[model samples]
Every structure is written in C-alpha cells, then in structure tokens.
Target chain A: MENLLGIAIGAILINNIVLTKFLGLCPFFGVSTRLKNATTMGLAVTFVMTASSILTWLVYEYLLVPLHIQYMRIVVFILVIASFVQLTEMFIKASSPTLHRSLGIYLPLITTNCAILGVTLMNTVVEGYSLIAATVNGVATGVGFILALVLMAGLRERLELADPPQAFQGLPLAFISAALLALAFQGFSGMIL
Target chain B: MKFQEFTKGIIKNNAVFALALGLCPTLAITTSVENALGMSLAFAFVLISSNLIISALKRFIPQEVRIPCFIVIIASLVTAIDLFIHGYSPTLYEHLGIFLPLIVVNCIILGRAEAFASKHSVSDTFLDAAGVSVGFALAIISVSAIRELLGSGTIVIFGHEVVPAFTSSPAVVMLLPPGAFLTIGILLALLKRAKVI
Candidate 1:
C-alpha cells in the first residue's frame, strides 16, 4: 500500500535515523572510517533492527499490553534487543567466519547501540506502527543508516588525503563533514506523499 | 587518590569530549538548555546508581553474564527515572521522548560499567561515575548553550531569559542535527588547538 511506501521513504530519507534522529551515532562516527567496515556494520544493524522490531512489536502487543505492564517497555524492549544482537553474533560466527571476524569488533558495540533500541521503541511505543509497518520502518531506518554511513565513509576515504588545520585533522574534520552532509540531508524534511 | 579519579573524568577522560561515548543524548535532547539539564540529571541518576549496584554485585554477576546483568540494572534504572520524570514534569518528559529511555543503551554508562565499575571498589566506582556524569553534564550543557544562543539568539533557562538575544538573524542550523555536530566538532577542535582536550 501507499502507506507502507510512505513509511519506507519517510524513514530512509525524511527521518533518516542517523542523520536526523541521532541514533547509532557511535558506529556512525567510529566504524565509518572505511567503506568495508561501514557497509558491514550497516547490514548487521539492519538485520538486528528488522528482527528486533518484529519481535518487540509482537511482545508489546501480546505480552506487555495483556499484562498491563506497558511501563516496563524500557526494561523489556532492551532485553529483547540485547538477546537478538547476541543471536545475530552467534549466527554470523557460525555461518560466515569471515563476516564474523570483519564485524566482530562492531557486534558487541551494536548491543549498546541506541539506534536499534531507539527504533524498536519508536515503532512500538512512539509511532505505534503495526507489525508489518514496524518491520518496514526498521528495515528502512537501517537502510537510512547504511546510506548515511556509506556516504560518510566515501567522503572520509577522500578526506584522508586532504590537509586541514592541525586541530581539524581527525574527528574534528569528520564531524564538520557530517555537518555539511546533515545540512544537505536536512533539505529532505517536510516532503509530502 | 579517590579525588583524582573523580577529577580526571572531568577533563582528562571526559566521557563526551575525549571518548565521544555519549553522543546519542548529547545530540538528541540538546536542543535547549532545559532539555539538556533534564537529560543530564536522568543520565547521572542511572549511571551513578548502576555503577553503585554493579560494583557491589560485580563479583557475583559472573564474567559471562555481567554484560546482560549490567544492562538489566541500567535499564531498570532508566525505566524508573523515565517514569518518575514523566510524572514530575510532563513537559520535560515529552521533550525527551524516546531518548530518555534510550539511556539504557548509552555507551558511556555501559562502557563505564564494564571498564571501571566492574573492576574497582564500590566507592571508587561511585566517584568515577559521578566524575564522568559531571563531565558529561558539562559537555552537554555547553553544547546546548551554544546551540540555543546561536540558533535562538537568546539563552533561556527554566522560563527566564538568562542571556538576551544578540543577533537578529541567528544561524538556525545550530539548533538542528548539524548544529550538534558542528558545535561538538568545533569544540573538540578548539580544545585540541588550545591543548585543553
């Protein structure tokens, strides 16, 4: 339906989880040093976000609502997200050793990533999206994160050669680049379906 | 020695400026000074309490399950603070939104639990957490102040105009996502240039 498409587009561009929502920023700045690492982190986060969104939505609707402990959402949603991150780590380790190694450093970091948990909570608590809608939002948000990170990676890859002031050499320069990128992305706001 | 541990977190090992560990809340709720203060209070509460409990129970938590345990403690604390703040100030609660609860996943809290609290004694952990919390508070407050002043042309705290508008045409971007990055990015750079970081 058009509604779903709107949600997907809205998440990916208009409300980009990374550039706008300020979620998963740790990896956004940390792992974005290289295209390979950035893409891998993006895919991993996308997987976890989609899986956790579905799971958390179901839990919120089925368990939390029925139990009348909706206030326990923070505690409940985080446990669910942490468990899923663990499962993804284990699965990746077993299925693809290379990816596991490539993503190994970031896997643990993802557990603490506010982006994954932030989206899940947003889907269930804030936006109140249905399961299908929540899943789409999650996937789209992940895609958004990937888009931002990959773009940043490409930019930073070239930034390595550019000579800036002594103070603006490393993260300072990266943050400035992100500012411009975010300003560019800010133009995407307020688009209608 | 204990005083040194607390003092170091302010500058030498600042959670936000040096480590860049607490970027989520630093950017999300820092649109205004009040929001920043509310968030800092909530963050300090969860971090300090979690550090105290985790340090006390670190030995029994078992190495394998310590992370999950730290998470549970921190999440429970966040939920409590979230509810309490909502009841106390519906306005602040609404402004904070999901970022309030997202404190459970803030890397600064978890990173400290793993690196410092789990290793040190309870008192040491408490001082360390307090220091890091203060450092984080200072960083967020400064960023929020900069954003509000430049973006809004004034500084208002708790409904009072503490600082009047200086510019008729403020750089509104300072109040947006880019502003957060710009503020912190330049802050870090200036600190580096002055050897303050």
Candidate 2:
C-alpha cells in the first residue's frame, strides 16, 4: 500500500506527464484555452490512459513476453490505442450524445496523443510496473495532466484581458507561461515519498 | 521534381516552428546537440521511407483505414530503427530514452503521410519528406545548441567538446524542463520579431 501511494504521488507531482515528461503536448496547448474543454479533454485522456494501460499490461505480460516479440511493442501498443479510442468514440456517441458533442474532434485526437502511449509504454517497459501498479500510475498521470491543463487554462483565460506585445501574442506567451508552470512543478522534485 | 516542394518545408511550413506539429520530441530529446543529431537522422530515415512507401501504395490502401495503415507502416519503421540504434549506438540509444520509440506517435511523420504523401507522387513526396525533416532537424539542433551552451556552459558532440566552457557556473535551469520552454518561447518571439518564421 505504501508503495502504491508513492507511485501515485510520484506520478502526479514529480513525473507529471505533460509538465515534466513532455508527453501529450498537442492537447496541452490546443484544448487548454477553455476550462471546460480542458476538463473534458482531460477526462477523455484519463479514461483512455487507464484503460489502455491495463490492456497493454496484459498483452505485454501474457502475449509479447511469452512469444519473444517484444520488438513489436511500438506497433502493437499504438494499434491497441487506436482501436480503443475508436471504441470509446463509438460508445460515447451511442450512449451520451451531449458528451460526444462536447468532446467533438478532441475525442478522436486522443488516439494520436502521445501521453496515452507514453504512459502505457512507460508502465510496462520503463518502470516495469505490474498490472495494478500500471493502472494506478496511469490514473495518477492522467490526474497530473488534468492538473496542468486546468491551471494553464485558467491562466490563458485571464491572459485574454491583458495585452501583450505583438510578437508574443498567442503561442509565444503560452510557452512562457508553461515555462513558469514547469519551474513551479520542479519544486516538487525534492518532496519525500 | 518541383523546387517548391523542397523549399516549402524549410521555411514556409516548418514542422517544428511554423506548423508546431511535433513538440513532444522537439522538447524532450533536445537536451544536447548529439542527441538532436541522432534524433534528426532517425526521424529523417523514418519520414522519408514511410512517405515513399505510402505514396507508392496510396492507391491500394482503402480510404477509411488509411490512418491505421499509415500508422502501422510508421510504427514498423520506428521499431526497425529502434533496434538498429540499440544495436549500433547503445549510449545514444540510452540517452534518447523513450522518445526514440515515441517517434511512432510524432505527428510530423503521420501528418506528412496523410497530407502530402497521400495526394502527391512518389518523387514529390520524397522531396517533401526530405525538406520537412531538414526543417525539423534545424529547429531542434538550434534549440539544443542554445540549451546546451547556456545550461552546461559547453557544447559536446560525439565525445568532443565543440564549444569550450565559457563560465564555470551556468544557469542549470536551461538544462531542465523550464529551460526548454523558455528557450523555445524566446526563440519563437525573436523569430516573430524578425518575421523569419
């Protein structure tokens, strides 16, 4: 239990997927302008990451490792993620039209989002976490991503009222803000587990 | 062999700066010039090969499953490159870490395949891929050069000190995540001011 807590805290605070690891940056900048959209995108990513982590863990432990075809993980993991995203899109479209409408294009975009693949690959290959640990880490990473996205969205919304220089209007300003946020997140590195 | 196809990706539609397609690897593996060079080489290999294959087989791949087909091709290429790097250059492979495999998800490769390769001829797609890869290489190497110089006070490439240390103490922040963002942000602002990007 203590180990699980450490993993969760480490993933959320220390090794944040977006701020630290630099995964899933497209959605970080693209869908972060609005708080609602950021939240929706975050939830969608969390769902996919968690689901794919477990599924990939199973495949890695049971199928790939036994067959000695671990080199095929990149192709296998991505195909799984693409299929999973497709299934989720279909389910959302059928079950919840409003949520589907809100998600819109971002739903499909999650398939290409590197964060989902990063977490799955990291959990299995890098960290070598077990099935349950992988799931926990995936959820924690998603929450960390949400935390960063929400914070950035709030700052961007506030920036709308302030005037910046002509050269630093849109993306340049956002990059600067992200730099500061990244600086702040760095302070969490020394925290004791 | 249109000249415009080769020239456009360098400045007009740079994958990194203008289009902002593959920021993940752009920020992640660009800690040193050596890593940046290795990454650019690998990326160029995958991009050019995948573009060639996709453009050649564009007529056969169904429209509905084109994305998946493109992905499978890109992923297989990445895996081959990953194994080759691991076998040949263990140190660089270790330095690159997961970003090497993460190349499969780099939007630049897939974006090019879907947008240009699917529509253009084989030779045109080849030039397009080469141009975009060059653009990406320039962007990442520039970023990595600035980061390494300011962060570590030296520029080392392939076990050689290209730039001697200017100061004993450098701003270590430039080596961290914030440094990557700050460098890219300031670079973008400068490019805008000069109207270069």
Q: Name model 1 segments beyond 4 Å from true.
A: none
lDDT of 1 by residue, A5-105 (tens): 99999999999998899998999999999999899989988988899899999999999999999999988898898888888889989999998888888
What is the number of backbone collisions in each predicted candidate, taken in the order shown?
0, 0
The residue-by-residue lDDT of candidate 2 on B111-182, one tens digit each, is: 999999999999999999999999999999999999999999999998799999899999899989999999
| Model 2 Cα shift for residue A148 (angstroms) | 0.5
With candidate 2 superimposed using the best TM-score fit, by how many Å does residue A147's alpha carbon deviate from the native? 0.4
CA displacement after TM-score superposition, residue B178 of candidate 2 (Å): 0.3
Q: What is the TM-score of chain B alone in each candidate?
A: 0.97, 0.98
Candidate 2: which stretches are off by over 4 Å? none
State the lDDT of candidate 1 residue by residue for B102-159, as single tens digits: 9999989989999999999999998999999999999999999999999999999988
